[model samples]
Target: MANPRNPNRLPSSSSSSSSSSRSVASPPLSSPPRITTSSRAAPPPPLPSAATPPLPPRLRPPRAAPPLPGLRGLRLRAPGGASLHRTARVFPSPSSYEFEIKEKGSHLLRLHFYPFVARGYDLSSASFHVSASGFTLLANFTTADPVLKEFVLWIDSDKLVLSFVPAQASSFAFVNAIEVVSAPKDLIGDVAIVPNQLEKFNGVSRQALETLYRINVGGPKVTPFNDTLWRTWVPDNELFVESDSTSKTLSFSGRIAYQKYGASREVAPDNVYSTARVVDGSDSNHNMTWVFPVSSGYKYLIRLHFCDIASLALNQLYFNIYVNGNSGYGDFDLSDAAGHVLASPYYIDFVADADNSGKVIVTIGPSKLSSPSWIHGLLNGVEVMKMNNSIGSLDGDASVVLVTENPVKRGFGEFVRSILCGFAFMSLLGIVFMLVMRLRAESGRTVLWSPLPTDVSGGKWGQGFPVASGKLEL
Candidate 1:
């Protein structure tokens, strides 16, 4: 190819020029190095919007550990280095689970199960000893030998918690433990018995004679038959005549006697020898009445004894006794009557209503007599006794005696009556005083005639006449 040489090329001739021109031939400068720029600075990168804040640096969270496997076996360690394992396996059953613990050390270790069964579990059959220090639990199961496949044990606060896994055989398999804590010392010390000091001589059987000797010759003074006064007397006397087989009418100082003469011995006697007497041959049917004044609210005892000396063939005898007017009667056989009989001078006890003011009367009659000719009678001793509620009858025949011993004046009704009487008396005196004053006022007299006013201005008649008024002439 032919090349155009520049004047600066100088010599070297056409041949060198021709070769150099071929090598130097190139395209012109390529349009001033072809300057290029990014498109509008990428539009200012679209200026971050308020809707989306830049995300924080990514953080990795901690991973959780795997759960522990379920418990399969249970065991306990004792202080003596002995270990006890549950030998009998407990299988989940329709009702309960059964298991056994092999005997371990001498010192019992307390095993507590929880979620305490509220009710309906037969804890009585379950063999376990719970002490103040601890407790042990045994499972009751149906299967001969089943394994306890799973269980959990941990201390939740003060309580020991245990939970069991459900068996595939049953939907509701439960295992529980009991919690045992030490008993308070205060509770342990409170268990003690206190004895009474005044209980001596309470059950002693008093002698019949001694009891009779204590009877009052006059009527009842205090509580009719107080404990110290008459209860012993009546019972002792009852013992005396209970075995007596005499056919003669036996009489004691008081109006107490057995009627041996009549076909049926009645307590109603034809004669009573006390100072206060009912006229002889009065109505025999009338209950022999006696009055022992007592405080209105005081309690008393009234006793009655019946004696009969006729025949023993009479099987049944009945008596009606009244206490404060209440009819209390019972029928008895010869033997029973004998049992009620007082020894020589014993007193039986009976109670009087504290509100009763009248005397107690005892009437004896045959409820059912085997023979009409059998002599049934009444032997007598009645006593009123005093006692507190706590000390009651000591023996079968011995009865508790409670007497009202307050004085007569203390009665509320009597007190009110006295006050009313005083007021009435005072009122009567006031009326009398008023009547006397009225009578005196009526008797005193004042002259009805009025004196003519003495002629202050005297009528004048010469020397003797008083002076008359200025215009008057005599």
Candidate 2:
């Protein structure tokens, strides 16, 4: 008989008990639907379409062995949840897993590493390097908390091999579970727009991407069970910068309308579009902003999901979007973009460069084009994924050189600021030049003017212009 499942008793870093050998207790009550273990390699079973409910992930056990020949397979049981996380395989030496490819195309490779203490071993200290086919996924990776590394890689051959090597001979490697599922055919688009530059980024499907953040804006957390892609989406309470008083969360009761040539459920579940965070029309001082810390200097693929759940009619809501303070979309209209449909799902992809401060900021504000009565902003979801650098590495091994034809266009506010700065600099120069001329006149020496324009007059440059303005507002 299976014991009752306890969702609250989650796994932790340190376990209370230990044994000389690996402990293989009874499987958890909520085990995965199926676990395929065979002497031969097998490809993961195909999942249902996005319209159907998501089932438990089909995982193929990795071939692992301990250092000692006679030791039992190193496995530990988790107290609750799926069997995949309940038991983990520890590797004392280098190990590899070969999976047969059923469909040769882009596939999602997910590696789960949950740190725990069992059998007198601390899994958190295990340092390792992971590689898929030829691309290096992780190197010298060790973590105190559980982490799920997701990669979208192209599988051209019939077999896809994943190698796990320890950092050193004395060190070890371990993994809780592995998932290699067939990704959507159109998951990675061919081109992504550079937000501020407004240029097309071609060949985006060729590079590998690592999932950094999947945020459900203004909604509760959406776990894998409710998601069509078996992906987890976290709430935006901590990520969003606006307070509850300034912005409010809303949930829609109607069905989320998915249209052709638009974002489908495969891209993101309906749960994401059914709820939104909308700014208060009265609060004109602030915009709805979310910040995500990431590796500096790497280019990221930012996917912003939108739905008009807050509006009662078409063309009633409009807003502006910004990425890292750069203008992504100026006065974006939800109804017009979605073919005059309400509650329709829409998404935009932007290839943006992460700031040196190691953060990506997304902001949405009420647009001036909208009616005064409907002045507000809203968002549904946001997904930030890291694109592999030039050297084909996700984890900062080689510096990613930013290549762009058109530089970011400065805003009107910035142009105004620049003009003011130039005026200030010229005024200071004119004062210094006058002082020098005065001293030369007292000494009875010739004061020759330079070839550059030295006259700060009001003739052609603007009549009686004040160098120091009264008030310069942004």
Top candidate when judged by lDDT against the true structure: 2
- lDDT for each candidate structure: 0.25, 0.67
Span of ten consecutive residues with least summed lDDT in model 1: 16-25
Model 1 TM-score (2 dp): 0.23
Instruction: Write one digit per residue (lDDT tens) for candidate 1, span 70-128.
Output: 32322222223111121111212222111111211111112222111223332112222
The superposed Cα distance between candidate 1 and the true structure at residue 230, in angstroms, equals 12
Model 2 residue 141 distance off true place after TM-score fit, in angstroms: 0.6
TM-score of each: 0.23, 0.68
